[model samples]
Structures are given as structure tokens and as C-alpha cells.
Target: MEKADPVLERLEGQIAWYDRRSQYSQRWFKWLKGAVLVAAAAIPFLAGIEAPRLLIGGLGALIVVLEGLQQLNQYQHNWITYRSTCEALKHEKYLYLANAGPYASAQDPRALLAERVESLVSQEHARWVSAREEAKKTLEKLGP
Candidate 1:
């Protein structure tokens, strides 16, 4: 059996972390989309007024459509990223497990593996935090 390359193993770990993160991000997008749809549906009733009522309703509807489209685009992008990452990780994991029989266990190797995993986890956390911040900024741009 072929031995797993450490470089490939590390890449796989990173990819796996990203795939999970993408799944979570997609869920958030879905929720946002739903809220947009509900707001869009209520625009007419919510805008009940004589002056600028129709204008307000139209603007609300427009905003909802735009937000929904943006969320959908983000969702699609995340899915594509997630799929590619998952495939890479699976390939790397397969190779790593297959090659484990040959390599003699060493303290240094174990430490390296632990560090790699930790780094991947940290990177994923940072990505999620960045995403949240972006979402907050977007919301702020939309309004108070």
C-alpha cells in the first residue's frame, strides 16, 4: 500500500474544516433568505399609509428581492467550495489511512499531526468569525 504524504494529510485536514464551515454558513444564508421572503410578503400591509405608501412598499419588495438573490449567490458559492474541499479531504484521508501501516510511530510525528489539526481548527474558526463580521456589516449597510 502507498504511504500517505504529510503535506497531503495537512491539506485534507484544512479542506475538511472548510467543508464543515461552509455547511454552517449555508444554513445561515437559508435563514436570512427566509426572513427576506417573509418581509417581502408583508411589504404591502406594512406600508399602510397614504403618503409614499406605494413607494415604500415597492422599495421594501425590491430590497427583499435583492437580499434574497445575494443570499442565494452566496449559498451557491459556499456549496461549490464545500464540495471541492470535501473531495480533496476524502482523497487525502484515504491515502493517509492506507499508508499508516508502514510509518513507525514517533513522538515528533504525533506532535506535528496534533499541531496541524489545531491549526486547521483555528483557521476554520477565524473564517466563521470573519463571515459573521461581514454579515453584520451588510446588515448595517441595509439600515439600523
Candidate 2:
């Protein structure tokens, strides 16, 4: 049995992790959005049924809280960013394997490929940091 290339294995693992994360975030974002919408739309119906003020107000507050969490987490943004990074990494890996594109000229294709993957991951991290800071600022504007 031929042993797998370590670099290829690692790159494949990273891709799988990112893909899983992206899918999870996408699913949860959808669920959160649907829940928020349903709860919000139910407020009027609840009020019409003479539901307690607390009940109606609670649903309204729930909507606001759900929306706030969604904004703060930025799951949708992460999903896209992570997926993009994953694809870029995969592209680099394949290019290196095929000795195609820019990798075709590299004397040390493995090193070059590793560098490219690290760069892409670093870019994704930078984006996450910037996004978190932006989200913090937006939350501050909401005044605690």
C-alpha cells in the first residue's frame, strides 16, 4: 500500500474542515432567520388573541435578540470567507500536484504550495479579525 503524501493529506483535511464549518454555519443561519421571522410575525397574532402584554413583548424581544446574535456572529460572512479560502487552497494543491500554472516553474513545489495555503488561511484570519472588530463597533452603537 502506497503511503499518502503528508502535504496532500493535510491540505485535504483543512479543506474538509472548512467545508464542514461553512455548511454548519449556513444551516444554522437559515434556521435562525426562519425562527426570528416566525416569532416576529406571530406577535401581531398573539396580540390579536389578547395574549398577555408580557407574552407579546417577549416575542418582540426574542426577534431583536435573535437578529442581534446573527449580526454579531456573522456566520454567513464566515461561511463564505472560509469556503473561499478552502477553494483557493485546493486550487493551489491541485496546481502543485499537476505541476501546472505558477507551480510549474517552482524548484520546490511542495514548499511553494505550503506557503500559498498558509497565505490563504492567514488572509481568512485577517478578514475574521476585521469583521469581529466591525461587529463590535456596530454593537457599541447599539448602546449595550
Candidate 3:
């Protein structure tokens, strides 16, 4: 049994976290968008067939609600952001492994790797905190 390298572990963990979040957000974003599109497209069809007014109205409301959810949650933005972070982490890992890029002239690649890994994760956390704060302020402005 060997001690695990903390830098490698942190790098792998962050990569996994971002990748999972990216996929989850992407899935939700696509599902919601697809639902909205289908509901929107069905509107005219329902109208043409003289569907019940209540049914048509319900679908219209669904579209509005779904779009609102998408906008509010920002699934697309999260998906893209998380994915980009994940790839950035991967790039750092590769560069560290190859002792290239910023690590090419480093005295301690492992320590540098840890520092860079933490930096990337910290930046992501800062962005998330900022976004949440902005959303809170917007909601406050909107009032209850």
C-alpha cells in the first residue's frame, strides 16, 4: 500500500466533479429545451385539430414555465462553464504530467501542480459565489 499523491488526487477529484456537473447540467438543459420545443410545436397542431381550449392553454403555460425555469436555473451556462473548467483542469494535469507548459521550467512540478489545481478550483468557486450573489440581488429587486 502506497500513499496517494495529494496533487494527483486533487486534480482527479476536481476533474471528476466538473465533468459530472457539466454532464448533469447539459442533460437537464437539453431535456428542458426539448420539452419546450415540443410543447411549442404542438400548439398549432392542437389548434388545428380543435383541441380543447384548456389543453391548448395548459401547453402554452407549460412552455412559459419551462422557459422560465431554464432561464432562472441557467443550465446552459453551468454546463458550458463546468465543461470548460473540467477541460482546463485536464489540460493542467497533462501539462504537469509532461512537465511542459508552465511546468516546463518549474523546480517542483508536484508543488506547482497542486498550486495550479487549487487556483483553478478556487476561481470556479469564486465565479459560482458571484453568480449566486447576483441572482440573490436580482431576486431581491424582484421582491416577493
* lDDT over C-alpha atoms for residue 124 of model 1: 49
- Superposition error at 97 for model 2 (Å): 2.3
Rank by lDDT, highest first: 3, 2, 1
TM-score of 1: 0.44
Q: Specify the highest-lDDT model's number.
A: 3
Q: What is the lDDT of residue 31 in candidate 2?
A: 85
Task: Give me the runs in candidate 2 sitting further than 4 Å from their true place.
Answer: 1-4
| Sequence-dependent TM-score of model 3 | 0.90
Two-way TM-score contest, 1 vs 2, winner: 2
- Which scores better on lDDT, 1 or 3? 3
RMSD of each: 8.5, 1.8, 1.7
The global C-alpha lDDT for each of the candidates, from Candidate 1 onward, is 0.61, 0.87, 0.90
* Deviating ranges (above 4 Å) for candidate 1: 1-5, 44-73, 99-144
Candidate 1's displacement at residue 51, Å, is 12
Residue-wise C-alpha lDDT for candidate 3, range 1-144, written one tens digit per residue? 999987798889999999999999999999999999999999999999999999999999999889777767878878988999999999999998898998999999899898888898889888877776776676678667
lDDT of 2 at 119: 78
